[model samples]
Structure formats: C-alpha cells, structure tokens
Target: MTKQINLPFDDSGCGWYAALAPRPDVKRLQGRQQADYAVIGAGFAGLAAARRLAERLPEARILLVDAQRAGFGASGRNSGFVIDLPHKFALEHPDPAHKQRLLRLNRAAIGQLQGLVEKHRIDCQWSHAGKYQGAVGPRGQAYLDHFERLLGELGEPFRRAGREELKAVLGTGHYSDAIFTPGCYLMQPAALVTGLARSLPPNVELLEESPIRRLERDGQGGWILHGDEGSIATPTLLLGTSIFTQEFGYLRNRLLPVMTFASWTRPLTDAELARYGGQLDWGLTPADHAGTTVRMTRDRRLIIRNTYKHVPRYGRSTSDAMREQVRARHRGAFLARFPQLADVPFSHTWGGVYAISRNFTNFFGELDQGVYATACDNGVGAAWGTISGTLLADRAIGAGSEQLRDIEAVTGMPSRNPPEPFLGIGVRSRIQLAAWSSRSEL
Candidate 1:
C-alpha cells in the first residue's frame, strides 16, 4: 500500500503571516470551472506562471489555485532573502561558463521580481540592503573561505569584514568574521507574495482555499483537477506545488520534504533597540549550512531559523514537545549571539517544507502531454522558483530564450531516493549528525 501524504500547509503557523497586514478576502473555487490553462500551488512559481500565462495568452482563460490564501505557505514563511548568488552550500558548477550562466539566471529572476514590485508599488518593505555571511569559529571561517574563493572565481564582488566591523553591523560579537555580498534583496515575504498575488494580470483568476485532492487526465484530452469544493478542467496544467507534488506520485522518491523551523521575537521597544545597538535592519546567513540564520527586520523584531528534519508526511503542525525543543534551540542561538537581548521572547515559531534533491537540481520541464512542472527549489525557492515559473511559462507557450536554455541545461528530474524505511532512517540520521556537528554555530 502506498503511504498517504499529508498536506504541508495544513497548520504552518508562520510568524511572517501574522506580522503582515490583514489579507483581503479572496473567493474560493466553489463549482465547476474550465480554463485554457491552470496553475496549481500559488507560490512563487505558480504566481509567476499564472501572470506570465496571462501576458502571453491574453484571450486564454488562466486559473491559479491554492490550498490556502496566497503567501500562507512556504512562500510566505521564508526568511525573506531574495538571494542572487548560488546558495552558500550548494554544489558549485565545475565549469566557469556554466557557473556564469547560472548567475545570470539568478540575476534575471531578481530583476524580474524587482520590476514587478516597482511597477505595482507594492508596500512590502523591499530593501536593497545586501546580506552578510557570518562565520562563528574556526569551522565557520573555513566554510567562509571556501565561499569567498568561489565568489572570486565567479567574478562576483564581495567584501570581508572583521570581528569589530561585524559587531557594529550585526550587533553581535558571536561571529568571528563575515563576507558581505551586495546582490541580495530583502523584504517582508508575506507582504510581497500577497501583493504579487493581488497585482497579477486581470485575466488571471486566483482561487484560494481550494486544496486539490486529486488530479487526472480527462478522457476528453484535458486535465481534471478535483478540489475540496469544486473541479477544474483545463487543456494545459502546471504543477508548482514543490514537495507536495509527491502526493500526486510525481517526484516520489526523487524529492525529499525537509522541514525547517524559524521563530520571530516581539518587536523591540526603543530602549531595547538602544540596548541592542546595531543597524536597525540587516540579514545574515550562517557560514555553515546547518548553522542558524538570523535577521533583524525593519520592524525591530529578530528572526532566527535553524534545525532541519526529514518528514515524509509533510505535516506542518509540529508537536508541542518539538516546538519547545526548537524554541530551546532558537533561544540558545539567540542568547549566545546577543546576550544583551536575553530577556526578549520569541512571539511565534513555525515550520516550512522545502524540497531537496540529491543532485541539487530542479524538476523543470514538460512531464506529460499538456502537463508541466517546476519543483525542487534546492533551498533557494524565492529567486529560483520565480525564474523557473517564468521559464516554464515560456516553454509552455513555445517561446524560447537564452534564460530558458540556461535553466534547461542545469535542471532535470532528481535522482531516485532510497526506499522508505531506510530512506527515513538515513535522512534522519544525517540531519541529526549535521545538527550535532554544527551545535556551536547554532
């Protein structure tokens, strides 16, 4: 018997969602609907695909569906970094030309999002303040050195900062050294996704609270999507559901749903800010891949993300024991870095699912006749998903570009995963070992 997959969005208690303004009401799919093209998921990829489809086929009906409101899923739950460089620990492309091409694709994604945000005047607190990669000790410094060398080889500009300089910027002396890269943009993730959903072309219809229970090919040469309240029949379909695609038997063992936790503290008062004493806003990723990710938001709240678990069920509701465990980890990381803010308490904690593949590539291409997919974010969902969505849209419409070619060269279906019982055992053990190894950084 096949194991049933649980929905990741069922109970993601994201602090980013609560921090944003109240979302306007959106209509859910209630009855039978037909469209020329339908995009499922409504995340970074789905939203981008729907908007691009609308632009490409003005007369064609486009439908965008999601299980919950826009930005309520992983898209909104991210740490808000629109990274333009390769992820800190991702495998580097062996060929210099291939690496340059990949960087161009990342920049294109950032450029596309920047254009959209500016054109729509979205009030998502979009900031050009680049990010810092901070190292905690000898191990972290070694990782930073490797990262710096890769950046130099890629011809990317980055500056190294000493301990004092990092303390001034990060307000924490825990990091021994740092590298600042100016290509990243930060924003309130929930706000940006919500705004993007709202600004989608008028021709694209967004239906929320419409969880797709099943999808099948219709006998009449189209696709039938069964939702909680309705069904949709469309000629063309795009799956941007990320790891949830496993529920449909799409990526099966080829993708793993990794749950990562993040917590946000209550906004600090003026006196508390003075006591903390650092730049009011900044984001820093750990030099070590498993180390904690910290951010000081524009609203004076501190955010910390750490810990990873391989959860096959994709259930978003974490147990109280697990929550407390993660909170303890978060508190330890926070206090170790900023003892001055020991009194501050985290207002919320949540887990989000990210799909990882063994080879660190994406599942991007046509899966079947009239069916397409762009999943497996490889831990850089914001920028990568956006670009993949745009390129997938272009591919569906028979339009080609240099960007599409570059993406095609690097992306494909993931390698198969180990079978169940052992897969779980191995993944869990690996996560535990990694966490243990990076305990000091966390």
Candidate 2:
C-alpha cells in the first residue's frame, strides 16, 4: 500500500479564498465509489484534465476529488498572473524554436481558460491588463536585460519603462526599470479554480474534503484509493496532486517542494487610494526569481509575495511562527514599495507549496499500467499546468497531436535529485544565495 504522510489542507490566512463568499457543504466520498476514470486533486491541472476527459468521453463516469475545498490550496494562494510567455526561472534553452513552442503552449492555455470564464460568466475579476517585470538594482536590471533579449528572440512585443515611468504607472520609485508585456492576464486564482470546478461537465462528479489516504492495487487490473470514510475503485487514475504525488509511491526524489509566502493588505480607503496615484489594478513580477512580486487588486488591496523555503516535511514545517516571520518580511517589502500608505495593515498572510524539478521538467505520462499523472509544473502552474492537464487527458486515451509532441520533446523527464540530507542542504543553500543576490529587489 502507498501511504500518504501529508495532505493539502486549508490555510486560513489565504486572503484570496477569504475574500470570497463561503462555499456550501462539501460532498465527501462515502462507502464504495466507482469511476471509470479518477482525477485526483482539484487544482488547475486536475480540473482541466477532468473537464477534457469528460468532453471526450461523454459516457464515462469521472471522479474529481480533493482533500479540501476547491481553490483553497496552492491554486488559490498564487500571485494570480496567467503568464503567456516562457517563465524567466524555467529551464533555459538556447534554441529559439524550443522557446517559441513553450510560448505557444502557454498562450493556448490562456485561450482555453478565457473561453470557460466567458461561457460560464465566472465572476473572478478577470483582466487582460498585461504585467510588468521590474528591476530594483543592477543585478535585477541585468536579469531584466536577459529577459528582454529572450522576449525579442521570440518576437514578442514589449515596452520598456525606466524609473520615472514605472513610478508613474505603479506609484512607487522602488523599481528602477521594467518591461510591460501585453499578453498576460490577471484574476483571482481561487475564484477561477472554484468556478471551473462548479462548471464541470455533467458527467464529472466532484468530491471535496475527501483526502485519499492510501492506494493499493485491486485484484483485477484496477486500483483502490482508500480514504478515511470510503474507498474508490477505478481502472484509470490520473494524479495532479503536485508535490504530494510522492506520497503515492511515484516520482520519488525527482521533485522539490518549495514553500512561498504572501501577504495581502486591507482594502485601501478612498483617501489612501488617492494617495497611491498608480493605476487601480496592476501586477508586477520581479526580474530576479528571489525578489518580491507585487499586485494591486481590483478591490483596492495590495499583495506582496516573496521568500522561499525547502520544506521536505511539507505542511508540517509551515508553523505559525514561521508564517509570522515570513509575514514580517512581506511587511518590510510592502512598506519599501508603498511608504505613502504606512498605516495600511495586512489583513491576511499565508504560505503555499509548489513543486519544481531539478531539470525543470514535469512528469506527464503513464506511471504504471492503468495510471497516469501530470506533476511538478515548476512555478508556471496557472498556464502550463492547465494546458498540460488538458493534453494529458488526450494522451491517456491514445490521442496525439503536434502540440503534444512539442511539449513532450521539450519536457523530457524530471532529473533525479540527491538523497535526503544532502538534497536538503543543497537546496536550502542555493535558496539563501539567490535571496542574498536579489536582496535589493526584495
């Protein structure tokens, strides 16, 4: 049996989900349930996968299960940018052709998500206002220059903004330089995921607050997923559980669970909003990977996200004390950027988990007979994860396309990581070095 040691639970300090209305009672799995296909985890990937599978196999009974309510985990805790270009921190490839393929895939995801939001009339405050990649010091500027070169090579249009222009647009002089790329979208991530779950096809049954505790093979060619109150049997299993996939006895030592924290301030008063002379809503990504990400919500709240920790213990390591320390860092970063709103208090703070691979490749294929998975999306889970999950459904049914081949060619396989203590030491040290190098940007 594959035993799960950790699970995705609600982080009460998540402002994204807290800002929304309460959900109705969850339908947890009970007794013996059967599904033709089971898609685990209700985040971006699982939702897309289940939706796609349901679309193709209209007669199939598909189960989409999650440990907590939809959008209460990493999916909702993100900085909420649906980026359309290759991420700066993703594995670097010198081939422009490879980069172009990635760009196309990400854009395709954006288009797919846009269609659903419009069709369902999801009220997620969706925006196509673009995003700003900013630099605070010389090191960050150098990274931004590299990013600009990559953008140019990909034939993507971008506008450069210096200090004064950035200040005028963002209402802060903290950023020395920035590039505005007009293809990205912004929205409340939690709302998007929850809406997607609610709007799934009639054939898919979504079970929330049902944590799969263990997995064991059935006597036949199927598998049995054991939960606290019930079990599920399915001939086909697809896991989109992010880092938690390791607990199911696959992809061991091939993925890293990185913890990142964010803090959101209370809604700005009319006077405070006037004092902050920037656009009403805007998102800024740091040129340095370790720097801070800042955003102004449509509802007039400011969000500050930064800091990384390699927590092998997963959620067990994110204690209240640790969250408090991270929140303090966020407060410092927020004050540095918006000192005019010195009295603006943070209303929520939380830490989230996302998986990355040593070689920057996600697992997106069959793990064993009758089993498949799509995990480790690096940091671009919003777009890449969505597209990958959609394609994974197609691949599971023996379907093929040029897009599938392109993604497979570029994302070969996740490289194996070192064992235990060594791996922890290396990752933690690297994180510290990166943070130090990007200190000014933070």
Candidate 3:
C-alpha cells in the first residue's frame, strides 16, 4: 500500500543544508520522457545509484528526478558525520556472529566511501580524525563501558581514553571517559552530495522543481510517473524517497522518517577558537540522555542539534515542538559540556527530515520485478547512503554477488518495531533513565 505521508521540503523555507551549498542547477524535465530506469529523489541513494548505473550500463538512458534541487534534502542538512562506529549494540540478538559480520560490512562500506570520495575527488571535506564521544561522570563512564565492550567483543578497532587522555583531546574537564572509533569520519555533507550530483555523466538526465504526483502501471509493462512537467515511462523504477508519505502508497508503515533540528553558529572567533581548541576538530557531542551532535563548519561554527528520532519529519512542516526542544537542549547542553562558551551566540537554526527503517538501518533490494527500492538510513546516511547507492547500481548491472547482498538488513538493527511505537520507547526510555541516573548534576 502506498503511504499517505506529507512531504516536508514544500514547507520549510530553508534547510540546514543551505550553509554549504554547491548551488548546481540542472535543466527541468519537460513533456513526456522515457528511460531504462527512472530513479526518484536526488539525495544520496538516488544520485549514488544514478552515478554507478551509468558506469555499469554506459548505453542505458537514465533519469534522476527530485522534488527539489539535488542534494537539497536531508543529504544537505545532516550533521555530515560519516558514522564510523558500529550501530549501537542490540539488546536482543542470538549470536555474536551476526554482529561481527556487520562490523566487517561496515568496515568495507567505510573503505568504499573513502575510496570513492578520493577517487572521484569529492570535496566534502572528508576527514578521518575519528570521533570522541565524551563520557562524563560515573554514570557516563558506565555507558561508555557498555559500548566499549560491544566493540571489543565484535573485534572492532577501537581505543578507550581515560580521563587524562580525554581531557588532552577534548580540553574539557567535564568528561570522565571517552571512546574513540576510527569507523566514523566528518563530512561537508552538502558539498559531497552536490559534488556527486554534478558529477553525474551527461547521459543521466536530471530534473528540478519537479515531483512525482502519481505512478500508474502502463500497459507496456512499465511504470509511468506523472510529473508537473510531464510523464516519465521506464522499464525499471527506483523509489529513493526516504519516508513514503501518504503520497507514495507502496510503503505507509514500513519506513519511519524523522525530522531533526539543528542550529549552526557563525564562524567561531579567534577567542572562541582558543576557548574550545585551536584546531579544526571534526565535532564533539556529549554523552547524555539528549546528547547533541556538534561539528565545525569549514568556517568553524558550533553546529548543535538533537531532537526527534526514528520517524519521518522532513521538508516543509516540521513540528514546532521539535525545534523548541532542540533549542532548549542546545542552551543547556553547551553549558553542561563547556561552561567556557555558554555566552556564544548561535548563527542559525534549521531542521531537515531523514529516513529510518524497521531495522534502524538503510534497506535495499527488489520489492518486485522492475521496481527496486532503497532507503531508511535512520539517522546514519552520508557514507552509508554512498555505500547503498553503489551496491544497488552494481546489482542493476548484474555484477553484484549474493554474498554482497547484505542489504537484507537484520529485522531490528535497532529494533524490529517502531522505536517510539514500543521497541524504541522501551530501549530509549531505559537509556534515558540510565543516562539520568548516571549524571552527577544536570
């Protein structure tokens, strides 16, 4: 069944992605169009797929359609952190083998991302300094303990830092312990997406300010996507829209798209740089119940955000509650993390919606013949999206192997059910309790 969810991009006047935009403009689609494959949504999944598909099928005609400008969706607005660490340890699992295999897959995916960005010369400010997730206080220490053990057990290359080392790296007295993982990297997300969008070979046609209003099965064994400019007919169709609102009826409940809000401070002044650190650090987020993710803009501003998870809230009509709560968290979060910069003024605050799936991971595979789908990155896309796009493209070219068919993700990488519905509520609520119980004085 097609979902009846609302598209958010039509509402929000601006998104977090506007900060470092590529500003690449493509010609709009007009009249009737036909192609070997029609890919919808120009975010990572669609663009990635389009890029690879061209490399594999040089002769095939490809068309990538987007509701807005390419890379203008969550792809441009995300924290831009290339998640290196493993997905958090699961509360329910049969054996450690599945987790181990996933770690290997994650490593391969990370390697592939690094290789692709470098080979393609993608200028998304890819850096591999790793991430320092600060664990402060007694409770915070224990929380880091669980994650550390999970990585070690899964044989992930990780190192835990004591209070002294943590202070050395973070220059903060608030944190008690920390875990550094190499699997994650920082990215200039919009730049990366825009770079890829512009790199699409001339063969792949792109459309902007166009949306698929309806999909009708044609008598000729193809799907016709009705757009404002015109209709596109293709033998194969790929749905890259992360959250299928009521508009896309195929998936109403299968995917959860959540909107996350963020505010980027103006470039840090020299005084502010010295206050935090005199280096271009990737980003630092404290380990708390409502932990906020922070990163440096190429210009150096503290980008802070944390609100809403595992559901679809993107584009135009993001809730006021999500924005207010995130702003509140940012105000108090900085004070608790660094009393040194409590007076810094925020430059901008905006929100964007990203997709999450049943497994809290991106899912890819054929839904039916001639209709292959991919999406639901949870909060982790960027690198993973690149991984997914490349894999799907290879499959289309018949070069993909079953062993590489890891897209049939575990039923619940995070939880089988909706995180908020029951599974998420259960796990996150406990995590919150533990976080609260562990803090010294919030």
**Whole-model lDDT values for every prediction:** 0.87, 0.90, 0.66
lDDT of 2 by residue, 82-138 (tens): 999888655267887788888888999999999999999998889998999999999
lDDT of 1 at 71: 92
- TM-score quality measure for candidate 3: 0.86
Ordering by lDDT: 2, 1, 3
User: Candidate 2 versus the native: TM-score?
Assistant: 0.98
Error of 2 at 277 (Å): 1.1
Residue 6 of candidate 2: its Cα lDDT? 80
- In candidate 1, position 97 carries an lDDT of 74
Best by TM-score: 2
Query: What does the lDDT read for residue 73 in candidate 1?
Result: 91
- TM-score list, all predictions: 0.97, 0.98, 0.86
Model 3: per-residue Cα lDDT over 9-56, one tens digit each? 632423345565446556777899989988887887788788778878
lDDT computed for candidate 2: 0.90
Which stretch of 10 consecutive residues in model 2 shows the poorest summed lDDT? 88-97
Q: State the lDDT of candidate 1 residue by residue for 240-317, as single tens digits.
A: 889988776677789988889899899999988998888867999998899999999999989999999787767544
